[model samples]
Target: MEELWGRRVLLTKQFSAVLDAYQTFPAMIDQGAYMRCTRCNTELLKTAILLPSGFYYCPSCIQMGRIDSSLQLIHQAEPANQTREVFLDWQGTLTPAQEEISIALCHSLAQKKPHLIHAVTGAGKTEILFEAIYRALKKGGRVALASPRVDVCLELYPRLQEVFPKETIALLYGGNEQKYTYTSLVICTTHQLLHFYHAFDFLIVDEVDSFPFQGDKKLAYAVSQATKEDSCLTYLTATPPQALLKEIQASFIISQLPARFHRRPLPEPEFIWWNHWAAHSKKGTHLGKLYQLIDQLSQKNHVLLFCPSIHLMDCLFQHVQKHFPDLQVEKVHADDDQRKEKVTKMRQHHYQLFLCTTILERGVTFENVSVIILGANHPVFTKATLVQISGRVDRKGAYNFGRVCFLYDEQTVAMKLALKEIKLNNQLARKRGLVDEL
Candidate 1:
């Protein structure tokens, strides 16, 4: 029955073990001409959705499970658990800038106001969030930190576990094998929030600009529905999207952390002309420049080679393996079955060169890494994405500098914009005296 708390699930025989314990509600609400999905709130015309069996189903959330007119959704009101007297176990200290943002976050939570933290890539956003999270938990309030990317959630879970070791934190995401547990703290992807309704008193959306949360209406709806009426909602992003900016203009309290905790300048990308590189890569010929760059960078730092597409990345990965057999290199994309293991291997310095798609552009960090994009002009490489990919380098305080190269046939607007943004951030850090002279 604890597993049923705060969750809205379809009334299936699988849940018969707890079905009698909670009241059930209709899965779809009918309005004369249309029916709305109780989970996703997607509306469909009754005439367009009528089934031969006289049952209307919500196709919008069918991936979760078929919620048809015949089914019911059951949930238990979120209960305030008896929290430990002290939950935070971290011994690290926040920088002055981070401490200021942390205070602002706590104030927002106390006021139950929506807030946004527009911080730079390595600005210690998580550290800034700790105080607020602790305050909420101390009050026995349910808290959830959601992101759009599964990689981000995976990266954040262990860190949260380390900081709040005494608390039972549930990590939820699609394809996750971990069984659900009722707890005060939850780290999950935005999609998982669809299973919850008014569950959180303190909710945060990290990497708010990253897809599929960005420009995703259903995900936004889920975030809204998951929070209690008087709950505090916070958004954290290095790159602020137009939607967030507009919200700040309207009412949200905004905190801007322009410099990283390391107090170092952001690395600007160096554009190198590699004409006809794609054809050469596909044919496995005339890659001397690319080979030379990888060889030199790999000598001192790990190499992150970003390809524009999976097909191209796979082709290049084979070529790289053939050319540098002794160098431990691995390729990962969205659908790689061994993605998690491969990334872990890279983190342990087992892999010298990692070839990947933009799936790794944000949320994960690597120290002393040099970034090289195969096709900087590709449509898929947006300015925000390029910034995030470049940010993966030199993230730790020990390694405060690294290289970023944009290898392209022709530079695109996105490439130019990414460079401009990095430079602008550096200038801001200098103006604010947040970084020392190099």
Candidate 2:
């Protein structure tokens, strides 16, 4: 009981003995029982399999560690009240737009209202949350910062740790080995929130437009279950969906930052028509234009070549290496074992050419990098993804301008929409004097 204080634990049939030893409650319905999940309110159905021991298991959240019948979830009832002297160590200053939104966000969190910060990429959205998070921690309130991608969590953990060094900050993921502790700050993937129960006083969902969390009802339910009833929730995203926008228009507190932290407009994507380029590339014919583009760009800038699929990325990587033997090139995807190491190497300027899929589209930044979206017409490349990929360029203050080229066999609605959105944001930024002179 002492060890379980201020922690939520998911038990299974295998832990029946432990349930008997401690105060326990059913985490899910028994097999064949007409009961809904107390947390997500998901009804038991055929998917809930009956085990050999006459118990039912929820298959809905099996990916988040299984929750079976006869298993009891044990949660410490009392608030942890584990407060500490939390201080912001970050020395950077937020832009005026960011400062205004940051103050409103802190007030909204105090009032337990839902808010959304619609900021473009490289807008210093993370820094804006420091004030709100600091206030939450200082008041003995637990806070959780969640994102759909583990890469986002990996990037945010160290930064948040540096900002609130005295607070216990826990980073949770699928295979994390860290034991659950009474921590004031928790940074984790959105999927990991399924394991939490009414735990946080404040919840911030970053990259709300990204995958696994964007349209996932289960993940959304998990987020609701994880936070307290009165806990404030803040969403941050560059491209918000229609539903979220409607919510913002109806009631949610809304804030917008169209310009980046460097006060530069987003790099508009240039459309390059290459008819049947994929077939020609596979045939090793009509390679002059691509080679010329690479040759010209590789002279001074790092190139991120976005392929539609992993197989295509590999094929393109081989062809590029064969053609440009002197150039440093590498391919990465979701399954790459050395993805972190490769990204580090890329940041260290070890590789001039990075060929990848949408996996490198968001939550990653490189200075003086130009983007090439091969097969931009592919159905997989959505408008939001293209915007994010284009936003990757011109991120650093030292080099706040770069090229974004979309190589497509045919013009796609998504591609056109992406370009138009970027232009509109830049126009708005300039009109508001949020951007520097073009």
Quick one: best TM-score, which candidate? 1
**Model 1: per-residue Cα lDDT over 277-357, one tens digit each:** 889888899999999999988988989999988988888889999999999889999899999998878887788999999
lDDT of each: 0.88, 0.82
Which tens-of-lDDT digit does each residue in 1-438 have in candidate 2? 443544456654544655645556677754454545544446777444667886667766777666666666776543655666777798889888889999999999879999999989888899999999998888888899999988788878888888877767889887777876666788999987876777788999999889989988878988887878888988999999888798567667999999998887888999988888888666777878888888877776899999898877777788899999998999899889898889878878799899988988888878888888988999989999999999889887576346898998899899999999999999999998999976
Candidate 1: worst-modelled 10 consecutive residues by lDDT: 78-87
What's each prediction's clash count?
A: 0, 0
> How much is the lDDT of residue 218 in candidate 1?
79
* TM-score computed on alpha carbons, candidate 2: 0.93
Question: What is the TM-score of each predicted model, taking all chains together?
Answer: 0.95, 0.93
